[model samples]
Target: MAAPGTLRRFLATAWLITRKDITVEWRSREIIYTTVFFAASCILVFAFGFVKDGRPIDDVASAILWIAIAFSGTLALGRTFERERYNETLQALMLAPADRPAIYAGKLAGILLLMLAVEAVLVPLVALLFQAPLFRQPVLLVALLGSGTLGYAAVGTLFAAMLVRARSRDVLLPVLLYPITIPVIIAGVRGTAAAMAPDGGEMARAWVSMLVFFDVVFLTLSLWTFEAVMTE
Candidate 1:
């Protein structure tokens, strides 16, 4: 690979960080098992309310899906940075020569990857359990999940890093995170609902467009503030 421009270098650094996190998780199987289990268990618990005598109540699948994503995502984000905090590497990472935003991007990417893995299990289980035709509009569904998760991960990555130095980080993460990400969770739920709607995914396109726009805005704000946040 040629080291041509700043973009290449940034991406290279981000990938290295992502690979490191993933490699560690692969060896330990901690994040994956924990996230997936939490997400799955969330779905099963909701099964009681959503599933009727034999079928799921109308429009429940979308709610269940997003709830699982949000809850499990929080778990992944907290633990992802906790490793850095516990290993005493976060300070060194902050002091590294790389752009702080790039480091943030790398951590964000790793969390998103872990969440996606959890979603892979969650989505299929949702379809099977609730009989939600989630695959009806695969492309649209993917867009909603991708953009929504991006928005969620963008904010989460920042907060988890900031709270890495705090004593009550685990307690503080969801408190700080949920209020900002409600829009993301709502967009994801709405778009996903539209995608599986019998109306032929008409409104899903609009929601997808809006969610993508939100992703851009959230990521911009998060990246811009990352350096300042980490400095303290």
Candidate 2:
């Protein structure tokens, strides 16, 4: 595709990039399969390692859900950008006439969608394995997961892009991302736990609101700095 020539084409450019990533992944299915397996394995390990009387300890299910998300998300982010780096297409991508921030937005949107799809499977599995009532408040639960995952992905996409050319990015990605995303992780856990409770609507909504705000802040920062950050 040719480089975009006008600021008016920002969204179009972003969507084009997103479509490219999605099409590539659709052809290979490598990232999604590995991410799902890794996330499922994390849940299973937590289930077995932290069981009490053949059941996971109280509130452990929520924690496990977020932990699996964070871990597997980092894996997905690393590999997503790694493909560009490996193919030596990142420079070519950056050199395109499209807005750099639009590129970041495209990557963020694609990664966010992928994470949500993984969560759709992970959530049901966690409910079954841990006997948690994750779907009792389906609306609130989805809101929390969606907002929280957006916040997590907003930060992750930026860092993964920034570190794409680094030698130690695999090790460094989590090192940099986990600490920064602690608030997002905490909010996700709290909101999910609340949504699973019988009378926790108010609390769940509160956490979801906070997560939305965090998403806004993180995304704004990421988009604003993406151009300068990606500079050689």
Query: By TM-score, who's the top model here?
Result: 1
Collision pairs in model 1: none
Residue-wise C-alpha lDDT for candidate 2, range 55-132, written one tens digit per residue? 777888899999999999999999899999997898888999888998998899899988998998899999988989
RMSD of 1: 2.1
List the candidates' TM-scores in order.
Answer: 0.96, 0.95
Global CA lDDT computed for model 2: 0.92
Task: Assess candidate 1 and give its lDDT.
Answer: 0.89
Q: What is the lDDT of residue 130 in candidate 2?
A: 93
What lDDT tens digits, residue by residue, belong to model 1 across residues 165-184? 89999999999999989988
What candidate 1 gets wrong by more than 4 Å, as runs, is 1-4
Residue 157's lDDT within candidate 2 is 99
